[model samples]
Target: MEQWKKNLVVLWFGQFLVMAGMTMIIPFLSLYLQFDLGLTDQHEIGIWAGIIFAGNFVTSFIFQPIWGRLADRYGRKMMLLRSGFGMAVVMALMGFATTPWHLLLLRMLNGTISGFNPASIALISSTTPKNRMGFAMGTIQSGGIAGTILGPFIGGLLADTIGFRPIFYLTGAFLFAASLLALFIVKEPFDRAKAAAREQVSVLQGFRQLSGIRELTALFAVTFLIQFAMMSPMTLIPLYVQELHGTTENLAFFAGFVGSVTGLSNLVASPLLGRLSDRIGAERVLGCALLGAALAFIPQALAGTVWQLLAARFLLGVFLGGLIPAVNALIRKYTPDGMESRAYSFNTSTLSLGNMIGPITGGALSGWIGIQGLFILSGVLLLANAAWVWQSLLRKRPVRSKA
Candidate 1:
């Protein structure tokens, strides 16, 4: 009934569509390069695929803060619409690309304009009641996770049925539709005059001001580490699954299951843990969840069977669910007024940086240390991150005396 609630509901769907559209290309990206683009060499196809896939994140990492600053000055809803519509056009053009270079450039362009998720988050964070912030962040996060879990599967199916190009058109159509939904339904109570009256700052100045705060700096690191740890083992999961299963038959199915199971559990746990964080404290939820996530990775490193690894990943998801929402809640609590969008944008930039670096580092390390050892290394990094959270956030809280 409330305007903020309406915005949250609309933006949840917006997040879902944005993530789903972005990920839909994953299923057939290499296939598109090899078949449609006429790349005959397998190695060339692989290289092109990697480049095109990372291009979006590469540009996204650089541009998120710029967009965030604009959102703070103009309006978050406008930024959201700009991204949604801009990405819609770029995604549709990918369906028409005649070369790998064309696709790569389009992907980069899409990433350059991509700010729908962060803008939605900033808008919701600004409008939602402080007490309900955890729940709102968690609920919105579940939307993206849900989209991530389903996008590839749906893309694969649609690619087979309607063919690859049609899937791109379909994704673009869905994204456009989502944008229209927000345009009509989502109401942002942005005080443009008030925002205009505030002292204007460059994006670099904004970044420096936010990063100067110790708590925000620590929170930013936590964001990066969480993404890095999760994404590092991602590209190597299939090899580990193969080792555990000891067979090639059904390998794709098993690997897909392992890849998606974490998101499935994460989707279920985010809202629940978010509510718990609201009742107790986001700091407590974050600390305990980090420790739980760190411990969960140990079993993955030790598992001798694919089933064991699956169970471990599912457990890890339960804890992973708490990290982002709690972090977002804390960011809102600590950020100075009128700069919330910039703060969230900076955090998103760190998130994109982690996403870009994680797979590369994971792929590199897995060869030297092996996948199992890589798992152990990831766990150790998370444990160290947990310690950082304690020192920087949890331990510094002023104790309240009981009446």
Candidate 2:
């Protein structure tokens, strides 16, 4: 196989392992808080859960751009190794947490070290053939989705069987193995002298350089909105499913199924859509996917049955599948070659910001506006973003405006 193909194959498994470990905590988090950490109050558990979950993104949002700039100067592969190994240690330490604060501290450390996803994206983007960028990104994305689809299921099962602490150990072990695999399998043909010869700037200077590019900045905002719109209603999904099902028995099972179905469809659809985008145009694919996602949200908002919601969620996944890779590809296109990794890192920061804000907004909005209203609001936001993409991207004109 070609070097690029070789790199993709290696990163695929690495991504899956890393992503699975990350998502594995989702199912058992509140349980762990209650059973192990001795958080007796329901209100306290809710607050801690929110804090522990958001803590990682908070630090990651602050640090990803810094990592990206470093990746541009050194190499993405180096950054990947650093993140993969560092995360492994942090994850394992979580298993030793004796208190809620311990877990919270570990979680924050995890976020500070978390750059695996964006680092891997930047590496693959820099290495892959331009013509195959979409396919590469799509396939890479599928790995993460596969982990997400499998993680909660495995975590739930493991927590029931071997207990929660061991799950973290297992997650840490998997990450270590993944990083080890990358060490031998993934290769980067980095020319650092050439990179060093280019004008180097402070991280802030680099940020200014990126912010100055109008289309890239627009693309970054679109990336943020894409994540915001998609994630906004997810925190309320289980409750929505319960509302539709109206039964506690098998409620968790049904909720898990509904959650996994979207990821399942996303995993299957991403590479296929990416291939299609490569043949046609990533912008068009992104535009269509945005519109399809906006439309798909309607069925979900109006879903009278859990099955209806599942179907809608699955369709939403299929449409939303192509959006990220398309955005990544477009970012790669618009970015200067030497600064590609930093561009991706900055985009990743926006994504982290979206991730942080979405659930908080969703959780709050569901209370004030109802679950269905949150869904509709997400749809409306996507619709507006689609229009924005249409005006900003499809017009085929440069954005000369200042940031």
Candidate 3:
């Protein structure tokens, strides 16, 4: 492999390991909070569970943009190293949690401190040429998706056999290994002349730079909506599965399968859709993906069995697979060289915010309205986004030119 490809692979695998380690907690943490710690009452369990789950994303959301700007100012490589090493230590400490509050605090701290994805992404985006940005981002994205796909299955097995705390130790050890690899294998080619050439923009200045780009601002709006649509399902689906089946047996297995299915869809669709967007345009491709995603939710709401849900999730994954890469490419197309990291950072923070909100929203909705309501609401949001984008494009084009 070429040097850049090698870097991409290492970064990808490192991220994969880190995400996998973090997500292992998801499959079993609720049970740990309820049965293990005796947090009785379904409502109380929901509240604490939501907090433990959303805590990390909320903190991560707050810090992501800050980390992004820091990456640009100092170095992407440094940020990646910091995130990896920090997460490794934090995850190890999680194994020692003796109470729900302890776990929740650690999870919150995990989010505030951890940032491997943003760091690796900043480095990758900065290094990639605009033409190949979609492919590069897709590859990096697949790593995290792959980890999600794998985490539940592995976690389920560990939870059933070895126990929850052991999984944390395993996660910590793996992350420790990943951190060492990241510190040694990944290279950030710094240009002192170029670094000096970059204007010492403040945080507000970075926001100002994004504000000037109308397309990116609109794209960021779309990104938040897209994440809101996707993340809620991720937060609720495992619980939904548990409620439906009335057992945790094979929960990880099913959840992992669902997660893997999404990755599989992305793995299959990203390159194909990306190449298609390159030929046509990202706008049209994204519009189609959004519409298809809205349609796919129908089957999910109507799912009568776990198999049906699995199938719906797999197909849903296919439709939404290329959306992020397409969106990232659009942002890259619009953003200048030095500013790419901050833009992505800001966008990711928004995504983290969406992630933080999604679970809370899903849990609340599931409590009041029902899971089906979530599908309909999320679908309506996506359809609205698609219509808005389509109409906005139409408004921007000169009718006389078409004539």
Candidate 4:
């Protein structure tokens, strides 16, 4: 294989293993609280379960920017190593948890310590040539999509058949395995002088730097909106499938399938979109893609059958496929070279904030307004963000527009 292809594969595998560990906990946690831990009341269950999961995002939001800065000052490899070791420990300890509080603490620790994906992405971005960056990042992102597909399915199956404890053990083991992959298989082109001279910026400096970049600011805004809109889909899709009369035996499989298909779609679309973005510009692709996402949700809202919903999701996936790689590429296009990791860290933190807000908001809307309302709201928000980004980045088309 060529060097680009070789690096892409390693990065994808590394991300797949790391994210597999993280994603395993998401679908199973609420069930665990309700059945395994004996939290029976719906309100108590929601509150406690929310706490256990949200704690990680809260801690991660606070720490990601810091870690990104650290990655910039040190090296991407060092940051990846730290993330792998820290997450492995956290996942292992989760297996030993005895209560909700124990799980919450473990999760918080996981968030504070976890920064591997952003680091690995930064490394991939820095190591790959500019022309190939988008495809490279897209290929790696496909790994995350794969993990999302597999994690919940495996988590549910392992929990039901083998046991929940094994889920954690498996997660920890996978993360350790990813750590080794990062340590040995992944290679970086040397820039010893730049690496040695890199200076760590304060968290405030990192934040300030990200804010100052025009394209990055726009990207961040879209990040926030996309996250807020997608929260409902993430939290409620499985429930909706159940409402449509899907069987429990197929629940995990379907959920994983939805996620995996999205990744698969991205596998098909990302490289194409990335290449197109390089030709026509990232902003144009972003605007068109966001609009496509907004339109795709219409079918989702009106769907009367499982197949309809699946088709909608797959279409949504195709449109949304190139988003992350585009964001990273745009960030790279505009951000100072040495600050790549810090920029990604800020991006990750913004994403964490979205994760914190998306599910809760989606749950609330699903309960109060109805699922249709969730889709409507998500579509409207995305469309609005798409418009704003277009006006800011593409409409005016200033001579020096960073995008």
Local accuracy by lDDT, each model: 0.90, 0.87, 0.77, 0.79
Instruction: Give the CA lDDT, 0 to 100, for residue 115 in model 4.
Output: 93
For lDDT, the strongest prediction is 1
Give one digit per residue, the lDDT tens place, for model 1 in 1-403: 9988998899989888888887888999989888798999999998999999899999999999999999999999999999999998888988999999999999999999999999999989888997898999999999999888888888888988998888889889889999999999988889999999999999999998988877788889888988898899998899889999999999999999999999999999999999999999999999999999989989999998999999999999999999999988888888888888888999999999999899999988887887778778878888998998899788889343110
Query: Candidate 2 or 3, higher TM-score?
Result: 2
Model 4, stretches more than 4 Å misplaced? 1-4, 30-46, 190-200, 238-264, 396-403
Q: For residue 221, what is the lDDT in candidate 1?
A: 87
Compute the lDDT of residue 172 as modeled in candidate 2: 92
Model 3 agreement with the true structure over 1-403: per-residue lDDT tens digits: 6556767888888878877876777678888877677788889887887778778988887887788777777788887888888888888888888888999999999999877887787787667765666777778777887787677668888999988787888888888888788778777786657866788787678888886766677667677877787777766777667765578888877765665676678767766777677777777777788789888888888887778888887887877777877777767667766676678888888788777677668767877768878987888888887777676543474222110
TM-scores of all predicted structures: 0.97, 0.95, 0.85, 0.88
lDDT of 2 at 368: 87
Top-TM-score candidate index: 1
How would you order the candidates by lDDT, starting with the best?
A: 1, 2, 4, 3
- Mark the 10 consecutive residues where model 3 has the least summed lDDT: 394-403
Q: State the local distance difference test value for candidate 1.
A: 0.90
Question: What is residue 32's positional error in candidate 4, in angstroms?
Answer: 4.3
Q: Candidate 3, which segments miss by more than 4 Å at Cα?
A: 34-46, 233-260, 278-281, 302-309, 366-369, 391-403
Q: lDDT of model 1 at residue 83?
A: 96
List pairs with backbone clashes in candidate 2.
none
**If ranked by TM-score, best first, what sequence of candidates would result?**
1, 2, 4, 3
